[model samples]
Every structure is written in C-alpha cells, then in structure tokens.
Target: MTLNHFDDQFEDSPQAHDAERAEDLFVLLSCYLDGEVTPEERKQAERLLACDSEARQIYQQLSCISSGVQLMPVAENPVSAEETTAKVFARMRQQRQRRLAWGGTAIAAMFVAAVSGLSPHLGPNNQQFAHTPAPVSEDIGNLAPSETEPRSEQPLNREDITSRALFIE
Candidate 1:
C-alpha cells in the first residue's frame, strides 16, 4: 500500500481520541457562541477554549460564520400594511365581479335556449290556442239526470242520504 505524506508508524496512538475530542469541542464552542449551553457547559467550553488551541480556533470560525450570517440581507417589503390589504381586497372584488358576469351570461344563454326551443309552438301563426270560448247548448238544463245526479236542490236528511249511499263490507 502507498503511504501518504502524514503517515506514521504507530497504529494505536492518542490522535484518534484527540480527533473525537476536537469534534466534541467544536460542538461545545458552537453552542457557547449561540448562548445555547447551560452554565456548567458554558464553563466547560470556556475552560477548553482557554487551554486548547483547536477549541479556540473552532470558536473563532463559528463566531465568524454566525456574524456573517447575521450580516446577510433579509428583504423587507416596502409597501404599507393598508396598501397590501387594499390590493388583496381589490383582486378579490375583481374575481367576484368576473364570476357574477359569467353566471349572468350562463343564465341569459339558458333563457335564450328555452325560448328558441319553444319558438315553433309560441309563434304568431300557430293554431293550437283559441281566443273565443266554445259554444254551450241551451238544452243542457232539459237533459235527463242519471241515478248519480241529484233530482232536486232540496236539503238532504240522514234518510235521504241512505238512499244514495254505497256501502262496502
């Protein structure tokens, strides 16, 4: 196997343990800078930062990153709250007017369709309807009455009603 430039003879050295500790220290430094660490953790990070060059370097990098992010621009809308609200309401009104216009147009189209469909029967020259009433004969009063018809306009009693009543068992 080809050995790299930094390769050393020792396989079981303290470098691996130090690398893990450095990673933990980086996290501790980041938390400390963000003010997320507790009092005990803050003291631990401070002690590490004071004694360890790697921890101090990580803290400096984290500090720079945090400050750089804070310096970045966050866009703030220029329009006033009232203006934005008015614009939104205006858009809504426009939509409502459009819907109403479409609905009215649909109703008018349906009305025209109905009128066109029924035009043949409702035309001026159609002979289905008659203006004058049908002629009635004068002999209607003189015609003979059936058994179901009343003989006279006399007031009916219980006995008279029994004569015409059909009973079901």
Candidate 2:
C-alpha cells in the first residue's frame, strides 16, 4: 500500500501521532542496541520490531554487530571515566577561551564607543521611540455589543446552565 493509505489508517486510529513518532525512531534501533537511546526511543524501536519485518531484519543485523563486539578481547589501554571527563573539560575550556578572545574585542569596541560619546541617547541622529497606532476596522468596532441591545439582567441559575450546559452544546 502507498503512504497515503497508511496515513488514512493512522487518521482513523487514536494513536496516529504515536505511530508516526515510532516510525520516525525506527532508524534509532541501532542506538537502542548501543544503550544510547532514551526510554521513549527504546519503546518505539521495540514496537517497530514487533510489527515491521524490515525493522526486524535491521535489528537482527545490529544485534549481530553487538554480539561480534562482545566476542572481542578487552582493550589493553581502556580509558577510565575520569580520563574521559578530563578530556571533555579540556576541550570545553579551549572553546571558552576562544569565545572570550572574540568577546574581548566586542567589549573593547563598546568601551571606545561609550568613551567617544557615541551612545544611542548622546548620538546626533537620536530620535525618541515611537508607538505605532493599532489599525481601525469595522469588524473590530462591531465586535463589542452596543448599549442599544437589550441584555438579560437576570443571573444564570443551575437550571439555565443545565439546560444549555458547556459540553452538551
């Protein structure tokens, strides 16, 4: 069947949006095998594997790769968690330093502008802020009920509310 037919089936189902999300996560089945997937992603992958033959085949392929990796001998130079964290922090520090270097130039430029009296209010071309007026339309003007219309001054009772109830309407 075409995607349109599948879409029609989804439109008929209450869980249509959920099914679409699950289908989107089908590619993440490999991530599920790696323990890198979120709980929602795992659920979607499982649902897809249970129903889709193509997904099942891809899952089997990914499982084989995982099993193959497990069969290999442990690495002699296995990096510790602390070492990984340190390297990540080092990289972050380098990025922060680069950002600060660029930010310093901007700060210097702003200081020069302030010292040279080129600030917004001090500039010769400075203009007062203006408020734009809202557009006037007949539709908007007619929306409010006129004082000429007769309005019921009576307070609504339980019977009136029950007779013309919220959801019943």
Candidate 3:
C-alpha cells in the first residue's frame, strides 16, 4: 500500500486504541507545559483532548505529577557553625605549615650557599698559601728579562700619579 494508506491503517489499528497509547498525550502535554512542544504536536494534543476524555485526563494527571515533582521538598544535611569554623581553621593551619616549611628550606639553602662561598678562603689548606713569604728581590730579578734589551716603548702616563697625593708642608 501507499504511505497515506499505511498511516490510515496504523491510526485505525486496535493497538492505537490501547491505554499505552495515552503516553504520547502525556509527553505532548509535558512538552507543552515546558514550552517545548512543536506546533504540530500542540495541534495533535488539542485534537486528542477534544475527542478523547480519557487521553485528556491522562494528560492532566501527568502535568500534575510534573508540577508536584518540581515542588517536592529537597532534603539537606545540617551543618553547625562551629563545624564550619573548625574546617576553615584546619585549612588555614595546613597552608601556614606549608609556607613555613618552604621558607625554612629557602633559609637553609641561603646558609649553605654562604658557607660554601666562605669555605675556600677560611679552609685549613689555604693557611699555608696565605702565610707564604714574598719571593726574594734577586729571584724576581733573575726571572725578569733584561730591562736594557730593546722593547716596545710604554704608553705615556695620562696623569701624574703624585698629583693625587697631598702633602702638607
């Protein structure tokens, strides 16, 4: 058969008259209440309500259930003020302890760096090097090349060194 004939047959079928078919009317009514039903569904629901009192009653019952479900009281657990305060205090203490630990680690790192910097200067092995005497003038003379030998001329002094010193007469 053609599509139109099949639609007519389905509409006239015994199954379509069953109470289970009222569920469609309930769904349409819920969508209507929620402002979501399409124009075609709204027209179909109106036609059903005008033609079938049972379908209309079912739609009304579903709408009431929807509204009732939305209005029902929700249960909430009771929390005391003292309990909330204690929770806040505990969180603050945890944060404070973390900050103190990080600060202490930074301070310890700085101290280690300071000690490392001073270690080479103050170490026991460095004492002998620090106390060693200056080389004898004759030994320094032996190590130097002869000053009478030809060498590059020194750059002239830009300023006299004695000019910086003040001697009171």
Global Cα lDDT for candidate 3:
0.76
User: Which lDDT value does model 3 have at 114?
Assistant: 80
Question: All candidates' TM-scores?
Answer: 0.38, 0.30, 0.33
Please give, for residues 1-169, the per-residue lDDT of candidate 3 as tens digits: 9999998987788886674476666677778777788899888878887999987788788788888999998758767889999999999999999999999999999998788767976554565422333334666556777878887788756354334444432
Q: Pick the candidate with the highest TM-score.
A: 1
The deviation in Å at residue 142 for candidate 1 is 87
* Off by more than 4 A, model 2: 1-26, 75-169
**Higher-ranked by lDDT: 2 or 3:** 2
How much does candidate 2 score in TM-score?
Answer: 0.30
lDDT of 1 at 6: 38
Model 1 lDDT per residue over 1-169, tens place: 4464334433246886677788888888888998999999998998988898988889889999999999999779678899999999999999999999999999999998888767976655666633343344578864676788767987778765655555432
Which one wins on lDDT? 1
| Clash counts for the predictions, in order | 0, 0, 0
Q: For residues 37-101, write the lDDT of model 2, one tens digit per residue.
A: 89988898789889988788778887898899899999899999999999999999999999999
Instruction: Give the least accurate 10-residue stretch of model 1, judged by summed lDDT.
Output: 4-13
